[model samples]
Target: MFYRIPSLGGLSPFVSLLSLALLAHNIDAASSGVINYGGDVPIGSKLVQVHVIYRHGDRNPKSPYPKSHYHDLKSWPGGWGELTDTGILQQIKLGILLKALYGPQNYGLLPEEFNVKIYKSVTTDVDRTIMSLIANQAGLWRSLKGKGIHEPDVQWNPTPFRVIADNKYDTIFGQNCSKAEKLVDMFRDERFEQLKNENLQLFQYAQENSGYEIMTHPTQICWLYDTLTVELLRKGIIPEWANALYPEPLESFLMEYLKAGSLTEEMRRLTGGPLLKTIITAMKNLTMGKDTIKMYAYSAHETSIYDVLAALCSPPKKPPGYTATLLFELFQYQNSFFLRILYRPGPDQTAFPMKIPGCGEQYICSLKKFEEITQHVLPKDLVAECTV
Candidate 1:
């Protein structure tokens, strides 16, 4: 017999163990409890454009604890925080997926030849994300080549990606937002304190098992869990103390804490404003027949995805895994445009249609209704709100 549990934060309607088991068996299986937007567009429908924002693929842990036993940087060929070969392959696969979905035969959204004006991509200055963009492009255009190019060994062409300057108020990373920091601090003290108190035993257990000191703060817990997760993924080593700690509860709490810390309505407006503005502007331009770019892609981080989800009022149950992707598809049907949102947890997984709250049974949301629902959440003046 299978049981269902309501997910926290209305992220998902239900969580089923059978679904999870199937997911484990085949990561590409359709996700359980997700509302699919159907595989093919209606007969009269045409895909007008697409905008995708995705997290970078797997990499070594960002930093190691000072007193931890996992201190050998040389052990990781990519060194600390660098993208690995595995990461590159994962992104390549994603690129192939995109090609299949948007390439000439599918939606005819992207041209065969590389055109700066036709397809545009941007990434943060960070190495992993920048490299991910390149890798993704390699996969995206693997089958297509430059005009009159006969180089036997050349299977790929250069694709341009703009690098956002790493300034204090950078939108992609949501860094150096004093307002966001203050908001997070206040929420931690007021709203999260009780949750922490209730989970004291779980936290204590983690502290005892984890080599690094585990703190009650959600961010700290998230960091610790991330570290543990990386270790398990890279090396088949689960810490000895993990056996007694009941790690699943700790993991669930960490996810809950992360959602609370970052997904708050106030936080979304402040941190996710620029991205929302970008998306909305693109969609509006498309509706007005003024949008030149056919496809837009942003290579970003988990925080970016989380904030975007929150702004849309459909926060995920937990953090997005490596190579997690959120796609915004605009379709033209009988002179009207509709939007479809899709989320894939990882590269090997099938994307699930995300139901925009209040959109009702039909997953397709009309442009006007989409704008009305999201208007309040998009930032009016990003700079002023992010000002220290």
Candidate 2:
């Protein structure tokens, strides 16, 4: 069910799951203005606006578990939780990809010059995220040399990114929400306990290898797995103690742990509400011809991307990879407007259009339908609900 498109340089763009039959023959046909991915686009559709939410790229482990034996923990160049040079490069590549997709001569969705009125970027006020945004912007506009205004050697343009205040409920990551905390406390219940008990052997194996007593809590275990996984990738060597640990079951448990908050309708509404509301409002503003901004970018965490995916009724197939992106695109066809959801699994992958369950096939739906189907999960009042 996946389709592959050859890149301009003859490299194969990553495979996408959108049906090949839905693609257009003329990718750059100006009349329709459809931004085709390997010739895939809804017939007669013209690209209008795009909103992207993405996780920061590769980074040093955020923290080590108590009594941890992670060897590289003390040697990471940026220390713990900060972006590494590799992380910057990952995001830079992503920015280059974005330029190819949306820059003026390509999709014509964004202007060549840096215009504050046409683009807005937002990021969680974290060092990694802010640095990622900077690196991404460098690649996004790498080709544009500002109208001979700056020094002749300058190849970069400033793309303003607003950093959301820390400790605010506006972003769920790294924030303290009492209600969300209370709801998440359900992991301590008997049901989750049974789930943990079923995986006791795996937990013990992880503990033995990690040099730490593995906590039975879902998030705690998930954190351990995530930290270790990244470390393994970075080090390119698996320790002898980890030989007995099976990766699949541990990953499943970690996914379950991460998704625990969105397992129920009420929890989904509470955890993902504010972000959903922001996206909906932006969509509304675009459709009404009131918003001039062509692209809105958010640099955030994996949890933020996952929660938004769950809110859209499209839980991610796996944890979002480094620089994983979720794009909400608004397309205009004559007098009608349609919305398409696309996901890029990583900086190296092609973006696949995603199906919004119950909305429609082809992964494209009427704007009204998009709103209707998503309304139930959108929080009516985030502050009031977050405290409940």
lDDT per model vs. reference? 0.69, 0.68
Best by TM-score: 2
Query: Which segments of model 1 are wrong by more than 4 Å?
Result: 1-41, 66-68, 143-154, 168-175, 189-196, 215-218, 245-247, 261-263
> Superposing all C-alpha atoms, what RMSD in Å does each candidate have to the true structure?
9.4, 7.5
Candidate 2 TM-score over all chains jointly: 0.83
Return the TM-score for each candidate structure.
0.83, 0.83
Residue lDDT tens for model 2, 41-73: 567788888888889988988887654556455
How far residue 222's Cα lies from its native spot in candidate 1, in Å, is 1.8
Stretches of candidate 2 off by over 4 Å are 1-41, 65-73, 146-154, 168-175, 188-192, 215-218
lDDT of each residue in 83-146, candidate 1, tens digit only: 8766766676677667657777556788766677778898987899998888787767553334
Alpha carbon RMSD to native, model 2: 7.5
